[model samples]
Target: MVLEKVVEILRNYKDEQDLEVTMASTFEELELDSLDTVELVMEIEEAFDTSIEMDGELQTIGDVVTLIEKAIA
Candidate 1:
């Protein structure tokens, strides 16, 4: 459920349909820079109604999902 929502947000944010986004997908692979990452994080926070702090430890979509799950937990 969380992964689907996250992927939906990512696809919408990037305006990409054909690109396959999975847990293994990295932000760099999605062509997201630091500023873009911050904006995406904001979107995720708003969607999840929670807060997330980053110290550049995240690398893959799985990392993000884990972070979100931890934050919400």
Candidate 2:
């Protein structure tokens, strides 16, 4: 799934990287600033061929995974 691929990308990061986002954490909790969020959305769009609205509700990695599943389904 695209969400799994996204998680894979994040998991491949270095220990010093700010990519340890998880389901229980908010984007802010992950230290993902505005730019990081934008980049992440873009990557997801390109990977899945779907556009995600920035409705301020996708606050965690799990939320994104659920959204992607809905889109794919």
Candidate 3:
């Protein structure tokens, strides 16, 4: 369900055909540049009303989803 929500957010910012978030998805494959990545993180935080930790391990959309799920849990 979180992945679906993340997909919706990505769809709003980028072409759906160009990106897809599965459990194994990656940021580079999703075509998110540094700025877009930061924007996404902020948006996710705001949308979920939770703080995602700023860490080096969050290097992909899948990583983000995991982080979000962990934070919310």
Best by lDDT: 1
Question: Which regions in candidate 3 have their CA more than 4 angstroms from the true location?
Answer: 15-18
Q: Candidate 1, which ten residues in sequence have the lowest lDDT sum?
A: 10-19
Candidates' lDDT values, in order?
0.88, 0.70, 0.80
lDDT of 2 by residue, 1-73 (tens): 6555777655543234456555676668767777787777777767788876778777788888777777777
RMSD of 2: 3.0
Q: TM-score, each model?
A: 0.92, 0.71, 0.83
lDDT of 1 by residue, 34-63 (tens): 899889988988999998878898788888
Error of 3 at 55 (Å): 2.1
lDDT of 3 by residue, 9-59 (tens): 888878665555686777778777778888888888888899887665767
What lDDT does model 2 reach? Answer: 0.70
All candidates: CA RMSD in angstroms?
1.0, 3.0, 1.8
TM-score of 2: 0.71
Clashing pairs in 2: none
Q: Model 3 clash pairs?
A: none
> In what order do the candidates fall by lDDT, top score first?
1, 3, 2
Q: Between prediction 1 and prediction 3, which has the larger lDDT?
A: 1
After superposing all C-alphas onto the true structure, candidate 1 shows an RMSD in angstroms of 1.0
